[model samples]
Target: MKLPLSADPPAFEIRYGITEEAARRKGYEIRKRTAPPDPSPLDALLKKMSPEAVKKWGETLGGPGGKEAPNVSVTMPNGDEVGAPTTGCDAEARTALWGSVEHWLLGQRFGSDFREGLISRAEKDPAMRALNVEWSQCMAAKSFADLESPAKAMDLAASFYEKGDETTAFTREVDLAIADAQCENDTDYVRKRRILEDRYLAAGMGGYETEIAATRELNRGALVRARTLLAS
Candidate 1:
């Protein structure tokens, strides 16, 4: 099987001094952006894919017979078991490059702790809470009541898809998304949240500097190896 290689640097290797700095830059970018007029092409295509088509695409990557791919189970620090598929050329390439899929999965699971902490702290921040209240009120005015956050708005949209005609669900979801974007824009929610998030993220990263540095070093090495592999 042939695997596609990307020329761009691995996202893991692209850091801006620290997590907080990266978050600040991202927040700035978000403040300068506007919502798109329509669903992204990937989203549109995913919504249009039939079950049979999805299965066929899976088979193309996972070999013939359309059987479900094998899964590798990783037990998290919380003792929860998460299963990730170990199939397709991409998975094979990752396993070859990383040495062990289980190790990579475990790293991913634990590596998110800093981000989770940052988000948790940010959400509880006074400024972020005040912004959420304002955004919720804006959403309420748009008839999408009780939306505490953008995540909640997304959950509400996802609920429509769970038990209705897909086309109708998609339309309703789009309308809700548009309303959400409007509310967020009116409240300047993204920028405000990002500011708070960056503050918390930077503060939180102080405790994880060693881990973050180690991860970045590993990522840099992996990128070098990947480039060598691709060049050959």
Candidate 2:
């Protein structure tokens, strides 16, 4: 699928930064969600324990001098560190955690922006931002001073439309001009033409010839025949 940022350029940079930041921020982000770790191992260990553990073995990483923290204490189901807070976590861990959280919240705040960045990096780079800037400019257009006649102006757009080219330019004007001339010879009322053959031109015997075909062989034809005879 073509992503919005595909055609734009700088969008990829934004994408990379956002992803890196989000990943780096995750450790801090997780800390924000969970309860703070206790400095005292006993307290920290106790907090992580299931209710059943405090009762079965009491609260201790290990009883007495064997006080080494259990493997489970340091690692979680997914193998990521569990107890350390963003504040106390090592630099790398802190970077990842903090990045992870910030990018997540950023996604929520500016959803489309965040998603576009991800897409730009994943799909097309270099073109995303450039195209976005161009689009932003187009959308901001404020004036119609450059407008052209509707029928003639859309030349470049002809390919996209199904209409043929001849009727594309000034056709409406030509049609309208001829229509205006014809309308001058016609009227709205039919007072004379209303009755079988009111005052409107009539054939006299048969229903007045209203059709061009019937009148073509009448006086009109006689005039043409006479002109031909004169010429001969």
Candidate 3:
């Protein structure tokens, strides 16, 4: 599979410091992603296959195992070795964008650390805590009580699976998701959350300035390469 460049920024970037309207728009987009359809018969059959059986089936079908890309490894800034090998169009696309699989892997590691730090800081912020209480109350009024934060709403929805059939569980989940979105809108949850996240992110970014700059440069170069590859 070939990875396509997204017009939108990464979710972490959108959550961290985007404008209130942008944040709300992103929240709406997230809420619209409902549960997937029921699994098909083919999917059910695949679930019954052992890992060894799956591997043998793939081999019979000429899967990547027989012509795997050369394994590549790189030492991260933290001195940990990272190894990831890709095959086919995915490998080719990644090579065009990052020069090697190692570079893409390094970017992923840095991005993960960057996202984790920002999220941790925002979640613990005093202002954010106050906002969550307001949002929770809004949700409670809609009969979805005891929601700690908007993030926890999905977990609550998923819990329906333990008590009911898939169809019923999915319906309840969708209802909860709709209520969650409404509560967020009524309480200005996304706007307030974004403001707090922006404050925390601004303060935190100073510590990761070098990493951020390198990531930006990597993305800019990748965009140019992506366009060139597409044209070719």
For model 2, the run of ten residues with the poorest summed lDDT: 1-10
Residue clash pairs of candidate 3: none
**Top candidate, metric lDDT:** 3
Order of candidate numbers by lDDT, starting with the best:
3, 1, 2
Clashes of each: 0, 25, 0
Candidate 2 ranges beyond 4 A from true positions? 1-117, 120-124, 143-232
Candidate 2 whole-model C-alpha lDDT, 0 to 1: 0.30
lDDT for model 1, on a 0 to 1 scale? 0.61
Q: Over the stretch 1-232, how does candidate 2's per-residue lDDT look in tens digits?
A: 1111111112322111112233333311222323465489766776787776664443221221222522211321122332321221232332343243222222222323333333324223234333333323332342212322111112222322244553342343233223222221232112211331221123222332342233333434445554766788
Candidate 2 at 149: error in angstroms? 32
Candidate 3 lDDT over residue span 106-148, tens digit each? 6666665555567677888888888889878988888989889
The lDDT for every candidate, in the order shown, is: 0.61, 0.30, 0.64
Over 87-168, each residue of candidate 1 has an lDDT whose tens digit, in order, gives 6654676666655555455555545644664677778888988998998899798898988887776667667757878667
Which parts of model 1 have CA positions greater than 4 angstroms off? 1-113, 227-232
Error of 3 at 232 (Å): 5.1
What TM-score would each prediction reach against the true structure? 0.53, 0.14, 0.57
